[model samples]
Target chain A: NAGVTQTPKFRILKIGQSMTLQCTQDMNHNYMYWYRQDPGMGLKLIYYSVGAGITDKGEVPNGYNVSRSTTEDFPLRLELAAPSQTSVYFCASSSLAVYFTDTQYFGPGTRLTVL
Target chain B: GESVGLHLPTLSVQEGDNSIINCAYSNSASDYFIWYKQESGKGPQFIIDIRSNMDKRQGQRVTVLLNKTVKHLSLQIAATQPGDSAVYFCAEGPIDHGSSNTGKLIFGQGTTLQVKP
Candidate 1:
């Protein structure tokens, strides 16, 4: 199985531009997450979904939106992208819940640069 | 914002030596803790994890220690190899809200481990 797959491996966005970072998992996991890692900083949670049709905000949900239309896909949308939004974006999924175990598997990552 | 942070910004160790990375979390209600290793140009990989009910857990070559009283967490790697060089992160999960099994995770800044030969 492809575990988790993320699209747009790298992208550069102009200020105020928008884009969507795609994520998909083949593990049939119920929990999906979107996180961004800045230079020398820890990964910050952007949005998460416990299951399809259910989504919620995380610590750094600003400038981002997520929709879980299906179990295999959870996409992150960035609106009016700013320089602050530039970072390495990673999508992850876990067989169990976030609290059940920290054994979430991750996608390669999408590197975004906002100019 | 919830602050789960690493005590050291970076660490350097010999290829065959052991390595220890420490983390400090502020939320006492956090019931779950995890350690992830992120290699260059790759996503974070689960190293090991420890629950609030347990003090330590061991994986293949990695171990996680959780001290709930002081909100401290640590990851130890024995016989570190070059592949072990990466950024290590410690994450915490609050017990309430969302669900007992599924909730948001608060990640620490991260400690970069450099394994030198």
Candidate 2:
């Protein structure tokens, strides 16, 4: 089913520069999430969406923003990039029926380096 | 703040041997726990999960054991293969109500498993 897909496999941005990381899922999942993984560390939630037109901030949402205009798309926007934002960004999805404990299918990830 | 931590940063084992990875969580209210395997340059993938109601759950050659008494979580892999070499992370989630009920998970630092043939 191609599970989850993310574009711009790798990107590098200068300070204050902005870019969007695109994510798409064809599993018809009702929930979508964005997470960042630092070197030698686990992932930290950035933002998430319950469904179309519904989005909320996650653990580390200070430098990022997100919007869910459709069920298959959830894009993370960096308004003013900073060095702290340089990390591997991953997009994941899960079904609403089993969102509590279901497996969150992840994309290959978009590695962003902010210099 | 709740956190999940791995006991070891790296584990080396023979290909035919069994491997055990340990994790400790600070939140007693956490009901759901998951184990994820991440290969280099790739995102984390779910290996298995267990709820607070159960102490042990088995899947194929892997098994997850949860101990609420001491707040410990362990993942056991039998007859590990070279393909099993990856970073393993233990995540705690769905801790009670409110913000945690939103289905968020707190991941551990992760343990790198190296299987030697």
Candidate 3:
């Protein structure tokens, strides 16, 4: 079973460009999250969805949006991409709330570079 | 503002030796703690976790120790190996069963583990 999968493994975006980073999970987890890992930094939460049709912003969500229409997919949209947005994005899924201290399985991540 | 931080930025150990990584948290109300390991070009993988209710938890060859009184957390690897070389992160969050809670995790700057053969 492919636990968590992310598309567009690598991408380069010009300034002001837009793109969607796709994520999918075969585990059917109710909890999905989008996190960005900057160079030499821990993962920072950008957005999260507890279940289908529900989404919320996390620590750094200024330039990103997320939609969770189905339990298997959660895509992160980058609008007017900037160099600050250039970072590896990782998608994760878990059965229980991370606030409950549940383990999260992560995707292979998408390397994004904005110039 | 909640924050998690590691005591050491890098830890080098000889193969077959034991390794210990230390972390601290600023949130007293944080009830959950977790450790993740990331390789060169991969996502962070769940290594182990602990709750405020427990002092220690073990899995395979790894152990997580939580000290709520001092807001300290540690990850112990029984035997270091080349494959164990990676960046390790400690994350903290509070207990929130509410639907509105987004389950945010405050992560620390990771500690790079370098294992020597």
Candidate 4:
């Protein structure tokens, strides 16, 4: 089902540069999320959307922004990129039926290096 | 803030041996837990999950045990295989304070498991 797919497997951005990481899911999931994983660290939530037209900040959303204009797409935008934003970005989606313990399916991930 | 942490940063075991990965969570309110395995250069994959209502749950060759009293969770992999070599992360999902099930997951630092044949 290509469950979830992300673009630009890897990227390197210069300081102050801006870029968008694209994510798409065909599972018809209502929930989508963006997370960043640092070396030797767990993933930190960047942003998430409950459904189309709904978006909210997560644990580490300072350098990023997101929008959910459609149910199948959730893109993360990094503005004025900094070195601190260098990390592996992952996109995940899950259904709301099993809301109590929804199992999140993740994409391959986008490796970003801000220099 | 609430956090989930692993007991060990790395674990090495024989291919045929069983492996147990431990995790400790600070939030007593957390009711749902999950274990994920991430291979090199790949995103994390779901391995198993357990709810606060059940102390133990078993999957194919893996089992998850949750101890709410001590706020501890463990994942046991039987006959660990080379394919099992990866970073294991434990995530906790606290009960949704709001109306909807946002499914906010708090992940642990992760444990790198090495299976030697």
Instruction: Give TM-scores for every candidate, taking all chains together and pairing residue i with residue i.
Output: 0.93, 0.95, 0.96, 0.97
Candidate 3: chain B TM-score equals 0.97
Return the clash pairs for model 4, or none. Answer: none
| Most DockQ-accurate candidate | 4
lDDT string for model 1 (A1-115, tens) is 8899999999999999999999999999998999998888888888888899999888789899999999999999999999999899999997774335546789999999999
CAPRI band for model 4: medium
> What tens digits encode model 3's per-residue C-alpha lDDT throughout A1-115?
9899999999999999999999999998988999999899888999999899999888899999999999999999999999999999999988875346577889999999999
Tell me how each candidate scores on DockQ against the true complex. 0.60, 0.51, 0.59, 0.63
Q: Which regions of candidate 4 are displaced past 4 Å?
A: none
* Candidate 2 chain A: 10-residue stretch with minimal lDDT: A94-103
Q: Cα deviation of B40 in candidate 3 (Å)? A: 0.9
- Tens-digit lDDT track for model 2 on B1-117? 899999999999999899999999999988889999999999899999999999999998999999999999999999999999999999998744543345678899999999999
**Ranking according to lDDT, highest score first:** 4, 2, 3, 1
Interface RMSD values, listed in order for every candidate = 3.0, 3.1, 2.4, 2.0
What is the C-alpha lDDT profile of model 2 across A1-115, one tens digit per residue? 8989999999999999999999999999878999999999989999998789989898899989999999999999999999999999999998744435566889999999999
Q: Write the per-residue lDDT of candidate 3 for residues B24-66, one digit (tens) a residue.
A: 9999988889999999988888898898999999998999999
**Candidate 4 residue B5 C-alpha distance from true site, Å:** 0.4
Cand. 4: chain B TM-score:
0.96
